[model samples]
Target: MSNDMLRSFFLGGFECSSHRRADGVRLDLLRTTTHDVLAGSDYRQLQNCGISTVRDGLRWHLIEVSPGQYDWSSFLPMLRGAAECQTEVIWDLCHYGWPDHLDIWSPEFVSSFSRFAAAAAELIRSETGRSGLYCPVNEMSFWAWAGGDSEKINPCATGRGAELKRQLVRAAIAATDEIRKVDPQARFITAEPLINVSGGSGDQAWQTEAENYRLSQFEATDLLTGCLEPELGGRIDNIDFIGLNFYPDNQWYLGGSTIPLGHHSYRPLSDMLVEAYERYRRPLVISETGAEGSAAPAWMHYVCSEVEDALRRGVPIKGICLYPVLDYPGWENDRTCEVGLLGTPGPGGERQVHHRLLDEMRRYGHLSDLARKAGSFADA
Candidate 1:
């Protein structure tokens, strides 16, 4: 773990999603989090907390104003900010935002995305002299279900989850291929929500359905690694890390019902981590996890304990990232979600740090050190 590429045992993440809403209004989380305006200060805060590694994103819609041309204006500040703060960033090349002109299902989509990814990689390498770590297309499964099947975004391909998933997987594969050509040392972290589903009634049919639903979580990663579809050009080299995003309500029973945490029916997060690591045989990260307001500290406690348990079980748990480290406006109504360790900004771009949450994180930071020190070498 000495040369851990993440550069930190504990990590923080900025909410950089730039997805357009159902009403056609794009939500720039970076703006809401004020990271767009205060990235340097945000990175300094992370460093002050001993978190040198972080997750940020590229706003594809803003960057690629035209087909192949790129506008780095929106993202350049954050790039400079990270360097100024001496932070290491894992950039999300596409966080649910693409150029308005590109049809998601068109052949041009994959090529355009691949080109953007390559250019982004080149920029990062040229600035940082590192082959960049990336989550090329974050949460493909979730995006497909929320944005593709539902009317959460443009294209509104209702009931076309499978088709959308296939297209997204193709784009991710192509993006990865293109990135490697530009930065051969690049590493990828494929993030998808990790969940536990149960048959609440315990009926045979529901049980089978629940199992299948749970397995569906790995669709994108499976496609990338060539486990299910070799035609996508997936291979061992395509995957470097497995990022399992967890939250309070991640586990649930089928039919949109949630299984309460600590309930017998609710599988522990530690078990889920082991399952992913054993299945993928790659270093794992809790790519995102946090709760809003009052539950924040307690949620971190629970997550830290589960991650510790997983590490003891020989899982190569690399790092735990506190996502949305800064609070942002909710996508549904622009109402503020007080889920970050830091709160809303003032005229000077200063956010109020939640002392309680900061204390909890610092307290758990010690445990993370031990967890990393004892991780399994096979995945490392």
Candidate 2:
């Protein structure tokens, strides 16, 4: 674990997705959470809580209105806000949304995306003089399953999971290549669902099926680094950092049952981190990890403890990002999901802090330093 890698040991993220639902209803999470309007204040709040690094997004569909045109009107202000607040951001170029004219499966899609990524990188470099940190396209495996196979979101095509995964991997690789051409010092983060699937029933056949599901989690990164798909224009250098998005329901039985984090059958998250490190030998980050309301503090405690355990075992964990640091409406139904350290915004744009989660964050910050101190003493 290195504090020098990011602006803060703990990072915060805003939910900035612009995905369209299966029924053609498009979502603008930034708008719902009011981050679009209050970027400066929101970032300022995070900084006050000791998090100067954040994850944010640019709505590609809104910006890339036409084939070759990009209107930075929507994203520029947020970038400026981050600069104003002295926040370091890992910008998500595409968070499950694209322009209407683009077909994700077509070759033109890859070309258009590459152009967009390069232009975006150049824009950031010119506007802020920062060597960019970006997740080119967020959660490829999750997107493929949720949108492509299950028909939950845009470009909803059923039974095309494998095809969609390949297309996304191709587009990401193309974007990475072009982005580097524009900004060679840029760092790329490949974030995908990190899950462990199992057969609650101990039948050998069901166990094998569960293993297959679990292994699919690595497809995106493997494809990016050319381990899975060498023909898809992947190269080893494409992998800079490994980002894993883990949550409560991440580990489950293939038959739709969950393995709660602390249950006897639940696998230790530190073990999962070790597995990932052994696979790629890359620096890791918990790109997204948070739970709603009262569960937030406990969930964060579990994650942070596992992170420390991973650190003790020599895993190069960069940092952990608390995703959606602002409360937002649920995607499926418009119910308020009481996630984030900050509550819903008020008339004057003030937010109430979740004292529980904040306490957990502070405690862990103290403990991380204590662990390091103890390790140094042991070495001495």
Report the lDDT tens digits of candidate 2 across residue range 1-380. Answer: 34327777788888987989988999999989888988998889888999999999999999998889989999999999999888999999999999989988899999999999999999999999977899999999999998889999988889998899899999999999999998998888887989988777678988888899899899888998999869998877886779999999898878788888777768899899989988998778899999987899999999999988877777777778898888889998989988898888889887888888999999888544543443333223
Candidate whose TM-score is highest: 1
10 residues in a row with least lDDT, candidate 1: 371-380
Model 1, C-alpha of 160: deviation from truth (Å): 0.8
Cα error, candidate 1, residue 123 (Å) = 1.0
The alpha-carbon deviation from the true structure for residue 307 of candidate 1, after best TM-score superposition, in angstroms, is 0.5
Residue 363, model 2: lDDT of 85
Q: What pairs collide in candidate 1?
A: none
lDDT (Cα, tens digit) per residue for candidate 1, span 217-287: 98888888999889878886787888988989998989967898878898988888888987888888899
Q: For residue 86, give model 2's deviation from the true position in Å.
A: 1.2
Compared with the true structure, all predictions reach lDDT values of 0.85, 0.87
In model 2, what are the clashing residue pairs, if there are any? Answer: none
